[model samples]
Target: MTKHNSPLLGSHMSLSKSTNYLEGVVNETVNQNANTFMIFTGAPQNTKRVPVETFKIAEMNQLIDYHEIDKSKLVVHAPYLINLSNPVNETVWKFSIDFLLEEIKRCEALGIHLLVLHPGAYTKGSLEQGLQQLIKALDLVTDYESPVLIALETMSGKGTEVGGQLDDLAFVLQQVKKPERIGVCLDTCHLHDAGYQIQNWPEFKNNLKQLLPLDKVKVIHLNDSKNVCGAKKDRHENIGYGQIGFDTLVEIVWDEELTTVPKILETPYIDNLSPYKKEIKCLLSRSFNQDLK
Candidate 1:
């Protein structure tokens, strides 16, 4: 196996409807040869909460030891109900804070190093105001001893999403006192829909360099966009199966500068495992082969 210094390559896998059990999910990813993976800590809907289970924690540790997965390679996506930018009421905001705190606690117990979050929709207010709300909510959460880094994901600019642009995200990070705890998760589909020209390597590199430091970027959501550039849509297609194409991904995966950042696919699952395997093979081929030269 080629040992690349870059973060491990993998996809976000789903556990059952229950957030309490993660053993099967971890095992499935390991069986798929994934050294790194992402999972949602709870159900996607707004109702119901699943408390973390003890056995799942034990299984997670066992898998990590047995598979020798680096503790830093695992990531957990917070639940969908969390809207850091929501200005509805104090109760809602409090709920969001509690949800995130619980998520951090669970991740800490499991030794997961990254938590990817969507920078919430602002609904009926200025983007700046919404950002302030997000910062406030984050500030209220107590810190954990886990090495986990909280990554705010870029959005597709649909509705009132706060982190659609690099500037918006940068603003939030700047306001937050604990800079070390804050990082970025760049979603390819969202970036494309946000009007970033990622097809060209030089342009891509320049854009990223100008917006945020490469080191501040901790995670990459490797998905293709069903919508065109600047469409402000969040539809995700399989790798190379949508508008972004395989060549563009090749450029991204082989970039020496971004090799240290972990990349996880959020693509729709195909009927069988072939699609995931094929995508991984494609990424590996592009990274190691000289055909692109």
Candidate 2:
């Protein structure tokens, strides 16, 4: 086995209903020897949420503390159904706001502080209008007192997605009333799909620093893309098995400045089993496992 120097590395663990949801996720993280992880408060596709109280939060915390996982880096992702960028439907827009607030409350209950969210799609309206609406929605959502910070994810330019560009995120940050409650979750796959040539890390980092504060980057979805740069399709490939090769990914993951930010894997599973343990091991050892597919 390769000895490792771990960064704040982890993957998105599923909330298993078969066992204690909270404890189950935490155990998966520990099993992978990961120090931090991300999960949805409920299923990511819909609004169906089990009550937080029943998730065995106390036992889960014990497990987390026992494993020495950093609670602050543990993230809860908002559901896919909530689109804060919806421009035409007022009802959907309001639902998005309400649902996100409720997710924050859930995160508070779980004692997790970071919530990763996709900036959402316009669907039927112009990009500018969608951004304005998104900024408005965030202003309302962040007005309340909460320890949970919403980390807006960079999106693939798929369909009407509003956050594919750094300019879009920068605009939202500038316009939102509560910047303190907002942070950014950079996705390597999304950045590549949306045409940011991140293989040249120095150039990309320099550009990102100009647009967004480095401190505002709270989480990174360290995925490799199934599609090429400028593809605009959001397909995630397993690390080293995708277009973004292993060395580039290792460089990004071990960048000195981002050591504190949790790097998450949202890679595709192989044979219905998680590839995270193998992937995480490969990353930590700084070795490319060519057999990982």
Candidate 3:
């Protein structure tokens, strides 16, 4: 076991389901012993699109001050409708760009340092062409400030999604002139589904080191996969409840190289927030007593 703390331990909590609003959610998460946290700024479903309001920013700042959550420990998930790789007409592209820009601005205003986004799927074009489109779309967006890091999440490589592979993600980073403005949010479940052996500690670490530098890894989505490795399925199961066993999580919790990053659980919280608390506690209890050989 390695005495690791690179990623501050936390879980994703839904603000829409809570009665206490964003501030209450932060308080509850902090009370639960989370040093880091993730939240959806808008409704997850495609109901009425809610505009990002200024009051939300004020509330978020208040919560941050109350909880003392370092601005770096907080991350916001972008809306589900954004797809930079969409090969649709210019109208769809324009809508996605606007939506993503607004999300970036909201995150920036609230003092959140990172915003995790699913690099959109290419609907009808070749994968290569779609990737180029993604780069182009990112280039066109101007709402994000230099301080805000737009994190492109690794996908499950199920279809025409442009970010399943490390090379694909690197390609996007390479194309964008603002390299410092881009970062990565690695999801364990997605990596597993994309055929990475996350359960093997040495392999996992080496793979990441080869694919990306530690500095570029700004956030981690610590999820267990409901699907088998290489299945390209996107189902997220409770930690240790899916194909990703408890041993794998033990390795992750104790890994020395990742101790400083923000590892937020994206697990299913169907049984209220109790399951999330349990998951965080479980990881915290791991023995980070020695280095991995």
Candidate 4:
């Protein structure tokens, strides 16, 4: 039997102009010996996409099954250019909502369970209005009929983006019309940059207890931060190189509460996937050692 306790560790696979994005993700992730991974449905900035035909969907599912890939652990990252919180730009806001709806439909088509989405930037509005707009947009776009869960990502506190704060994300969860279809993805880099100090796991535990149920945390981005604590910058360094550092990053991923959650690396990709391969080995080695003890 496959071990139920092993973490679903992997990195986001690039999907540049590939005719086979879904199969590419499965092949690359399985090659890394990772149990799970993340991918964008299309180009993150543009709406251009590979046409999803009946054969494509069938092939994608067959490929995943052939690799013994766990569908629930597979994550579909929503495009980056969406701005559901843009209160001043009605055109952008409308597009964001529509784009989001389409993303969910794509997830459904691919049979992927979780969709990771940045909650979006406020652009030109108060934090209150920004959050309200996010809530409103979510309410508009959510579909109770779809099985896909939208996992709202924590942001680096840069600019006017929502979800830098845990409560900000929780509030959206509380207000959204379909709470059952929504969850959270905590990015370690964003958490540190947003000033959450999750490296201090005990305090982080306390914070997690205060903020939301641990089960509601559907995903974790395990990147280290390139900036200092409370810096509000979103730059990502490789696993051990930045502020989160080696020991803490290892410990964070191995924590029992997060072990079952899918942990993905959105780190700066270096040549030939060596960085992620090494990071996956490093983190899992520590975890295996801890299990032996």
lDDT of 3 by residue, 1-293 (tens): 11223348788776663455566667767766777788877775453544555235677666766666676768888887888887766787788888888778777666776888888888888788778878888887743554778889998999878788888887888778677878899898998999888888687777777766778888889888899999998899887778887778767766777776788888876645457666776677763222110
Flag regions of model 4 displaced more than 4 Å: 1-5, 16-20, 54-56, 271-274, 287-293
Error of 2 at 114 (Å): 0.5
Q: Against the hidden reference, what TM-scores do the models get?
A: 0.88, 0.97, 0.88, 0.91
Question: Model-by-model lDDT, in order?
Answer: 0.77, 0.89, 0.76, 0.81
For model 1, the local distance difference test gives 0.77
- Per-residue alpha-carbon lDDT of candidate 2 for residues 1-293, written as tens digits (9 for 90 to 100): 11135788999987877866888888888788788888887888888888999888998888877777778888888898889999999999999999998998999999999999998889889999899999999999988799999999999888999999999998898889999899999999999999999999989999999998999999999999999999999899999988877888999889998988999999999999899999998998999888887
* Candidate number with greatest lDDT: 2
What lDDT score is found at residue 87 in candidate 3? 72
- Please state the error at residue 197 of candidate 3 in Å: 1.0
- List, residue by residue over 1-293, the lDDT tens digit for candidate 4: 12346677888887543536566666667667787888887889999887655225665677667766677888889999998888889999999999888988888877888999998888878889999999898888774478888899999889888898999998988888888878999899999999987778778877787878888999999998889989999999887778878788888777887777899988886664346766787788864222211
Candidate 2 residue runs with Cα over 4 Å from true position:
1-5
Predicted model with the maximum TM-score:
2
Candidate 4 C-alpha error for residue 292, in Å: 25
RMSD of 2: 1.8
Pick the winner on TM-score between candidates 3 and 4: 4
Candidate 2 vs. true structure, TM-score: 0.97
